[model samples]
Target: MIDQLFLNNFKAFRSASIRLAPVTLLTGLNSSGKSTVLQSLALLRQSYDSGILMSIDGDTDSYGGFLLDGDLVELGTGQDLLHEDFASNPPGADPRISIAFTTTDKQQYGWTAQYVPEQDVLPLNLAIGPSDWRDAALFSRRFQYLQADRITPATTYPRSHHQAIGRGFLGARGEHAVNFLRHHAQDVVPEGHPLRHPEAGGHTLLDQVVAWMQELCPGVNLEASEIPGIDSVRLSFGFGGTAGLDSTRRRRPTNVGFGLTYALPIVVACLTAGPGSLILLENPEAHLHPRGQSRMASLIAAAASAGAQLIVETHSDHVLDGTRLAVKQGRLAAGDTAVHFFRGNGAGVEIITPTVAEDGSLSEWPEGFFDESENTLDQLLG
Candidate 1:
């Protein structure tokens, strides 16, 4: 697991070092640098995926550099990524962006990219690490990043053998989720894992997926199949009327409510969690009702309990409450969870961390941190 992350002249942060845990929650107001944290990690992964982050023995020409635009992220040029108040190298030199992280095993890795205003690929000035940085926790193949703008209900999804089947990627927007589900439907979920649903008919991936989806909308069954002779896969939903919906009919994703389809990738990602897995999620509670939002947090906590490290960016109070509930219920330890609230302070972003006690109580509730309901209620009563 990544124990700490350090960002220098990257987006909203001039320089900031954040301590992380097994399940870290990044909560804050809009554009307060919450997404920046996730983007920094994604930037490294994308660069590595494109062979830019690897150690190059020869002279650094354009052979190895940070790939700004790639399958995982599209950060544009260096100017778009460098901090507004980026630190200059010297009296005459240009600005630079630096990203570094320390793994739980005490391995420190750092990358420095020179800021070229018009260049998309920021040439690396230095790539410093243990040389085996790819073996690090965050750089492992077990990493999955699910962005906020994910696939909505669609007629069909793509079927990529190399991505979905080969790499087990759910896709940045979860475009490969259906194909992944279809291909791994029969794969057995390990026994004694938190992802293994108790009500699942069997320990298969599809069964576990359905059981978890039921938490959002009870009795909801899912199916993933290929469209013959095409490069796409199909997904449909069946309700058992347990949530007061029709049970007899199987419906395409478009026919079901938005929440079920929207939350499918999250369910699959959590169900597939393994030791040392790093799952980054943005707004897992999006399109979900209050109860469903809380349930999503439960699943997140369960995934963490099963040994995957999660870094979630969310604005939902229900997600916070559910995590607290998980702590109270002993599903996740308080020490293993970290919650950081980010906010703009006119100059830059400020992060405040509130400790979670064993009893589900927070050490502090900073203003504008998951207290909007009470803030509005007091005004209305006044």
Candidate 2:
């Protein structure tokens, strides 16, 4: 797992270091540099996947560089990624953007990219830190990144054999989720895994996913299948008799509620998590109700307890409280979780981390850290 992330001259940050844990929650207002954190990691992942962050035979520009556009993240030119107010460099040295990280194994890895305003590739002047660092969990094949604006209720989703089957990617927008599920539905979840729901019908991935989805809407069941001759897959939902529906009839995603489809990618990602998995989620609580949001937090906590590192960005207070409850109930240790509050003005961004106690209470609560409810209540009661 990554123990620390360092950003220098990167977007919106002149220099910043963030400590990560098994479960890290990034909460704050919109555009307060929260997405920037996830973007940085995605950028590196994209660059590496494109062979732009690897070592070169002789010339640094021959092979390794930062790919500004790639499968995982599409950052514009260097000017778009470089910090507006970059810190000063030594005399006669050109400005550059750098991202560095230290793993729990005490391995330090970093990369530096030259800035070119209109160029899509920011040529790197240095190779990845160590040869062995390439095997770190962050670079493993089990990594998944789900952006905030994900696929909503849809009739049919695309099916790509290479991506959904070979790579097991859920797509940045989770467009391949249906295809992935169709391909891996029967795969058995590991025993003693937190993702293995007690009420699940079996140890298969689909069974666990259905068990978790039932939390958002009881008696709900899902199905993923392929179109007869098209390069697409279909997703449908069914409600049992308890939900006033015929259990035999299946409804298309468009007919079902939005939360189910909206939360499908998150559910699949968490259920697939295992040792050395790095899952990055943006607003997993989106479109979910209060109790459903808290239940999602419990799933996230379970994934972390199962040995995956999850970094989630959320604005829901229930998500925060649910994570705390996980710690109190000993599902996750206080030391294995980190909560950060990002606050930004027009000029700069600030991040405050409140420590979690063994009892699940936070050491500090910054002004805007999920306290809007109390603020409004004070106004009404006064």
- TM-scores for the candidates: 0.95, 0.95
- Write down the lDDT of every candidate, Cα atoms only: 0.88, 0.87
Give the Å error, residue 77, model 2: 1.5
lDDT of 2 by residue, 287-329 (tens): 8989999999999999998899999999999999999999999
Candidate 1: Cα lDDT at 217: 85
Please provide, for model 1 over 1-382, each residue's C-alpha lDDT reduced to its tens digit, 9 standing for 90 to 100.
Answer: 8999999999999989998888999999999999999999999998888777747333455346788889888888988998998777674677879899988888878888888888889988877777566777566779899999999998999999999988888999988888998998989988888878788877788888888898898778888888999999999888774312235677999888789888999999998998899999999999999999999999999999889999999999999999999999999999999999999999898999999999999999999998889989999999
Q: Best candidate, lDDT-wise?
A: 1
Candidate 1: Cα lDDT at 28: 94
Model 2 clash pairs are 52-65
lDDT for 148 (candidate 1):
95
Per-residue lDDT value at 171 in model 1: 91
**C-alpha-based local distance difference test score of model 2:** 0.87
Clashing pairs in 1: none
Per-residue lDDT, model 1, residue 241, is: 42
List where candidate 1 sits over 4 angstroms from the true fold: 54-63, 89-92, 241-248
Report how far residue 50 has shifted in candidate 1, in Å: 1.1
